[model samples]
Target: MEKDKKIKLGISIGDLNGIGSEIIIKTFEDNRMLEFCTPVIFASIKTMSFFKKHFKSAINFHGINHTDQIIHGKVNVLNVWKENVSINFGDEDVKIGSYSVKSLEAATKALKEDAIDVLVTAPIHKHNIQSDSFKFPGHTNYLAEKLGGKSLMFMVTPTLKVGLLTDHVPVKDVPNYITSELIHEKIDTVYNSLIKDFRINKPRIAVLGINPHAGDNGVIGEEDDKVLRPTLEQIKSKGKMVYGPYSADSFFGSANYKNFDAIIASYHDQGLIPFKTIAFGHGVNYTAGLNKVRTSPDHGTAFEIAGKGEADYGSFKEAVFMALQIFKNREEYEEYSKNPLKKAPKKS
Candidate 1:
């Protein structure tokens, strides 16, 4: 790979009924973005046209059947569907749901085929997009199965990084999923992501407890004391810097996460509630531990603001930049891995 070459960023046009196309159009309309990488949007001309007209967007698109036709300076649209689809602005429809899957299907296939370097997925309607094809909870699980890696639903920002042990499961089922082995696997994934993905040297990880006040040391729950305590002790003995079982209420109130490199939450809302509350429109949901780099905006499809042009593009735009940066960071990490020992600094 050449250092000066631009990375090819692939984008899946999630749920057309929502704001996916609008944000994609608005993000590319900013000419300054072309300087970073060429973007290939996997959607049909009809969908892009619907958004461009509805949003009064000014971005120009170069449509082609294959990725080889990608134009560096224009928004490139890879036509996945041939028929002209109707643009149902704000409601969920069966036909639109199918197209969302098709776009993601085509994008992931291209990613595996090496047509694109990184992927930035737009938000999708999880319930509507469910089919025999996409049976997983969200992008993290689907990509984990598709790309062959243990996926971590990592929510990231400039200062904070959080990974989930249970993604998209019911609150009642979270405790059932929080076991010793699950703790080790997910926390190890988070620890590895901190070093390889974020370039953190000797990263420190914090673990969030499941029950209230981390089970109040068995007064409220037994799993935190029996399972988490022993597992964390074993992990600590393995020469890793990890701590916690911290109470969720006080953890965020004082911003205690600032002291660690990463935090492992027992479940989705445990970590994401605070993360979204703090960085709602600015955070990035990174699918770490996959062979390919994939990210999405922290927020979901804004059906209320579908065509209002009121949806903020900050999170999606940040997802794009974060993908490119991670691609570069992986390169540096690989080179560093080859030679971990830094030679003594040359005498000035």
Candidate 2:
């Protein structure tokens, strides 16, 4: 990745039967998007051609068979599969889900091999994308295993950022997952991401409680008082600006979230529900604390409006822009760390 080179943006076309194709087509249809990064879609041009025609888009793709063939200033489609496949909009098919997995695998491989600078994945269905090979609940977990990091499901926007302590866990099992060690790990991940990825020098973080009223001093629940409080206290003792155990019920409605750079929710819905409500079509689901940068629209496979051409592409476009910015921020952070400025000599 040369500094002068445009970032090789790798795209994983999500569930073909869903609205993934429509959003991707709409986002890149605007030729102005090519100015930021050279996008390489990890699906066949034949498949994409069908989408383009269906959407009535006037966009053309620079079809390539290999990553090396990718050209700058063009929407490049790398043929991950050659066969023309059937498409049924607004339907759930295991075969179609397998193609989503295929595209993701190819793009992920390219990312790991440094053939692509960053990855911006479209939405994928959680159910049909399950098999012996790909059994993860979502992209965050799968990427954490493949890319090797303490991946955090972070939903982000310019004015608000929210990170989940636990994602895709059953409500009954969330408290069991929240422990002293897990709290420390997620807090460290979010803190470091603020500095290195989002370029926040001194990040202020807040955590939401797992119980109603944050346990109300053990009346409602003891986990928040016994677990969350102690863990946050331990973290604050380390001189980190971490504060929390706030009642999740009133934290966001009271506008307390604006006081911190990031908020760590106790679970998935606690964080994502508010995040989507606030930034719905404009938020980016950034997978923080990973060795490589990855982001996706704050959405999922829109089965109801799959091929109606009514899907919104704003979030998808923002995901691309967010990934590019994070890549540059990480690059700059690395350069600064490698060659830090010499400190001024102490006065006599």
Candidate 3:
């Protein structure tokens, strides 16, 4: 945790059949990536060799039996699997799914052991990987559970940031999950994450209404006025700058998003639809309120474009850069808190 030490980043090679391997290979093509952190990929040497030939990437690989053997310039890969098997590119196989889960397990173990500073996960297909052994909804839930289940999903870009009140839930079931307690917990987590992780002091937060027109003043629905409004009042009493119950329809439009540091939405599509529209192929999905730093590209597994060299690496690059920036911010904030006299001027 020293300020001058390079962060030890552990990466999980998500769903080898998808574009995860391609993007991970493409991301390391930039030699400058080595300067930020020591990247260790939890995957098989055979699988990486297959990708190096298939994608025609210039990435060199180094086989290491342990994380202590990680080297820069060449991708330091831990041989998670002992057996060699044929890997059919772009084909869904349960064995590959099992292997993906194993890779993630190794990465999470390293994180828990304090062997790595941050985790950068690639995309994985939930449907293909949800067997009896690996039965989590996605990486967010799986990682949260491994880290004692105290985290929230927040999607971030340079222009906008959003935290989901309920993720991976059915639309009909979202309202039931949005209790007064849940709202308060999510708001508190987002506020603390902004200040501690992103170094934003006194962040202005906007909360989106569950119903249209903010329940049309209770004519359309009562959840916004009854559940959200009272919660905002409680948060305001604590001296936090939180506004809203704004109608979801006009909140993202009308350029209202620029006025706030973060937005809280009731469900998945309600927030992600607008965010993806604006920050498509550029957003990074961040898991805040966790003991460790974790981030992934906003996009999912691109099945159709897998292994064709057609998938874009923009979001993957953004996720890596965001992790580095947040790590730096956390370091500086810790230093400033300990020595207020050396505090730098706040950025405009």
Best by lDDT: 2
The residue-level lDDT of candidate 2 at 204 comes to 94
Candidate 3 local Cα displacement, residue 326, angstroms = 1.0
For residues 168-286, could you state the per-residue lDDT of candidate 3 as single tens digits? Answer: 99988977999999998899889988887776788999999988888999999899888989989998998999998888998888989999999999999999999999998999999
Which candidate's TM-score is highest?
A: 2
Residue range 1-348, candidate 2, lDDT tens digits? 476789999999999999988888888888898888999999999999999999899999989999999999999999999999899998999899999999999999999999999999998888889999889999999999999999999999988999999999999999999999999999999999998898888899999999988989999989998899999999999989999889998898999999999999999999999999999999999999999999999999989999999999999999999999999888778877877793321211
Winner on TM-score between 1 and 2 is 2
Candidate order, TM-score descending: 2, 1, 3
Shift of residue 119 alpha carbon in model 3, Å: 0.5
How do the residues 59-168 of candidate 1 rate in per-residue lDDT, one tens digit apiece? 88888899888877777899999898887778988678888889998999999899999999998888888877568667787888888887899999979888888889
Candidate 2 pairs with clashing backbones: none
lDDT of 1: 0.86
Task: Summing lDDT over every window of 10 consecutive residues in candidate 1, give the lowest-scoring window.
Answer: 339-348
lDDT of 3 at 278: 94
Considering summed lDDT, which 10 consecutive residues are worst modelled in model 2?
339-348
Ranking by lDDT: 2, 3, 1
